[model samples]
Target: MTAKPPISALTDHLGYWLRLVSNHVSASFARRLEAEGVAVAEWVVLRVLYDVDALAPSKLAARMGMTRGAISKLADKLVAKGLVDRADDLEDGRAHTLELTKAGRALVPRLAKLADANDRAFFAGLTAKEREGLKRLMERTAAQLGLDDIPVS
Candidate 1:
C-alpha cells in the first residue's frame, strides 16, 4: 500500500480544497441565516418541507442523511417555533408526517432569495455559463461517487 501523505502536504490535496471551500460556503450561509433566527440544518429542513405538503419523518431522515432521532428533535423545535406541524397520518394513525406551517411556507421564498443572493455575492465574477458548468460537473461527480440518490435539499 502507498504511504499516506503528511498533514503539511494537504495543500496539494483535492479533498482539502473541497473541504475548505465547503466550510467557507457553509459558514457564510449560516451567518446569513442567523439574522433570520434560523440554523443551517433548520433551514434545510424548512426548505425540504416547503415543496412537499407532507412527508414521513423517516423519509425526511433518509433524505437528509440524518438519524430518525435527529429528525424528531428538529421536528420538535420546528413545532415549538410554529414553523411545522407533526400529526398522525390520516391513512395510518399510528404513523406521523410533517407539514410546514403558514409562517414556514411564507419564509421559503425569502430564504431561497437569500441563498441566490449569497451565491451571486460569492461567485459574481463567474459567468452564468461557468456557474452552470460547475453545477453540471459537480452533479456528474456526485453521481460517479454513488450520491445520485441524495436529495438536493
Candidate 2:
C-alpha cells in the first residue's frame, strides 16, 4: 500500500476554526429565528429589505446571493404573510420591485432585537476586546475578499 499523508495540524487550522465558529453561529441564529416563526433565509430577505425603501427583484437577488426564482419564492411567502409587497417598477414595466409593508417594517426591529439577544447569548463570556478582535478580523477578511461593498445596513 502507498504511504499515507500525515495530518499536519487538524486541530487549529484556520479553515477548521472558521467552519466551527460559523456553524455554531448559524445554528444558534437559526434556532432564535425559529422561535420567531421565520426561517433563516426568510429573515435574510426581510433584513435586507428592512433598510431600503424598495429594490428591483434583480437587485435583491444579486445582493442576497440567491437566484431571482428563489427570491421570488421568498417574496411570495412574505407577500402571503402580509410582510411585503411587490409592484411593477415605474421605470420598467416588465420588472418588479419589492418593499416591506407596514407590518414588515414593524417586524424588523423586533427581529433585530432577537438578533442582538442571540449574539449576546452566544458571546456573553467573551471579553469586549475579544469581540472587537473578532469583528476586526472578520471585517479585514471581508475586505480582503472584496466584499466590503455589500452594505450590512
Candidate 3:
C-alpha cells in the first residue's frame, strides 16, 4: 500500500494567523463600541458621515462598499436612535439625503478616541515606525487582493 501524504497543520497557513489576530481585534473594538451604545456597523456609518454634511444613501452605500438595502436598514436604526436625519433631496424630490444629527456629531469624536485607545491597547508593543510599516503592508496586501469591502464588523 502507498503511504498517504501528511496533511498540513491549521497554523501552517498565513490566513490562519491573520484570522486569529483579526478576530481578537474586531471583538475588542466591538465591545468598546457596545459600551458606547453603538454597533460596529453603526460606527462605520457614523465615521463616514463625520466629515460630510449630507449624502444620498446610494452614495453612502457606494462609499461603504455595502448594498443600498443594508445602508437603508442601518439608516433606519440610526434614525430611530436620533443619530441620523433622513430628508428629501431638494434637487431631486424623489431622492433623499442623510445627515448626522447634533447628537451624532457630538458622539463621533468620543468614539474616535475610543478607537484610538483600542488600537493603542492592541498594538502597544509596536513602535510608531513599526505600526506605520504594518499598516502599509496591510494596505498593499488589501489592494493586491482587491479587498474593497469596508470592514463593518
Best by lDDT: 3
lDDT of 1 by residue, 1-153 (tens): 999876667678888987897777778888888888887788888988888888899998898888889889989988998999998988986789999999989987898888888888877888999989988998899978888434422
Q: Taking the tens digit of each residue's C-alpha lDDT, what string does model 3 give over 39-145?
A: 99899889888888888999988877889999999999999999999999998888999999999999999999999999999899999999999999999999999
How does each model score on lDDT?
Answer: 0.84, 0.83, 0.92
Candidate 1: regions farther than 4 A off: 1-8, 148-153
Q: List the residue pairs that clash in candidate 2.
A: none
- RMSD to the true structure for each prediction, in A, is 3.8, 2.6, 1.8
Q: Is candidate 1 or candidate 3 better by TM-score?
A: 3
What would you estimate as the lDDT of candidate 3? 0.92
Which segments of candidate 3 are over 4 A away from where they belong? 1-4
What TM-score, to 2 decimals, does candidate 1 have? 0.88
